[model samples]
Target: MPARARLADENVDFMSLMSEANRRRVLGKSTPVVYPAGTLLFREGDPARVILIESGLVRVFRTVPDGRQATVAFLRTREILGASLIVSDPPWVCAQIVIDSTITDLDVKTLRNVASTHIQVMTAVATQLAALVRNAHRLVALRSLGNITQRLAYDLLERACQSQLEMGRLDAMVTQEGLAASIGSSREVVSRAMKGLRAAGIIKTTPGVVRVVDPVRLSDTVRAFLRPT
Candidate 1:
């Protein structure tokens, strides 16, 4: 299969590893919160708390020694943040809402307690953590080595594939500014990259939206960068 097709077909619902009853048991203890864009869900050094994204997007970032915030991840619906906190300390990271969001703040104490007695919950947590690690590594590679165009292509294609899974659409509801942040570049650089992708017939962009016109070609752009050169 093409790399882009595989990414879209990949099952990202890590929580589905849990039994239905166990899934309900863990989530039933959570409190849903609706946050508008730009809201900080949590900040660096805040006490650990698990949040389940029911819908919308979140940008997880941390400040570096240079006082610049480095984006760690862009989390979407059906993903869990702070799941690692069940076994470790609160990380030096902050989660901010990038879009209007509905999230469930899981009762951490309950989650920990449930995990102690439930094998399914433990399995689910393991799956989620593994996914997080894989995403973190992929992000690092793209940012460290990819040029603006390749980075933007990967970011847009990633979100587009995610949207396809979640909403049955191949559109990423992101602005150029968001793309820049995701790829650790300036908006002007991202704009140029967007134009490149557009010219290649890989994507179509409008205000606050980028629809994938040729995901295979977009994935090729990203995949080419990842290949040993």
Candidate 2:
């Protein structure tokens, strides 16, 4: 709870849609849950509970036909998870939060109660749901996008290292195998693209971490695959 307490005290703006008052109000009643690396926050078919990320990361993925799990998306600080439950049906995906992460668990009723008094909060819910839809669309679009490698790269950078990307190891909850699953390809192909990026001085990889040494060049590499070659 210290982490979340510190966050609330700082009053740093994240979740742009929610006002500071509403954010604090929600966090006030929420219970803080901490988990270590590889902790499963929720699994496919589990009931979704409203979760506010105070710090750390959560990876959303689904099991595939080949007995491999494809990493799909992630949730970070100031972001809300299980937002879709507020506006639509339940989610059927597994989520793994990053190491030593703290998340505030709040139920749907409390959220609804708060949002009822605050239309702005309700608007935030709407935006969150819409973002989920867009992510799904991008997931489907990845398969159709030619040059799966480039598509993979673009997807990796889409939100892998959000907001504060720099020339250092990317602490993203993604990997080659996960990337293959996201773009509907094999790890071999994903690895080749990773190698190409490294050769081009755009990125460097070490085990599970990827450092974006040159963001502009990396974007150019992604663009190259997007256009007809």
Model 2 TM-score on a 0 to 1 scale? 0.59
Off by over 4 Å in 1: 1-11, 144-148, 153-192, 196-229
Which candidate achieves the best lDDT against the true structure?
1
TM accuracy, model 1:
0.65
Residue-by-residue lDDT tens digits, candidate 2, 1-229:
4433333222222356677888776666667878865577787878778787777766667876675666555555666777767667767787775435888886787777777888887777766665555555555454566476667666655534331222222344577888888778899988888888888887777776676665445545454432322
Question: Residue 40 lDDT in model 1?
Answer: 71
lDDT at 134, model 1 = 65
CA lDDT of every candidate: 0.73, 0.63
RMSD of 1: 8.3
Candidate 1, residue 151: Cα displacement in angstroms equals: 1.4
Top candidate, metric TM-score: 1
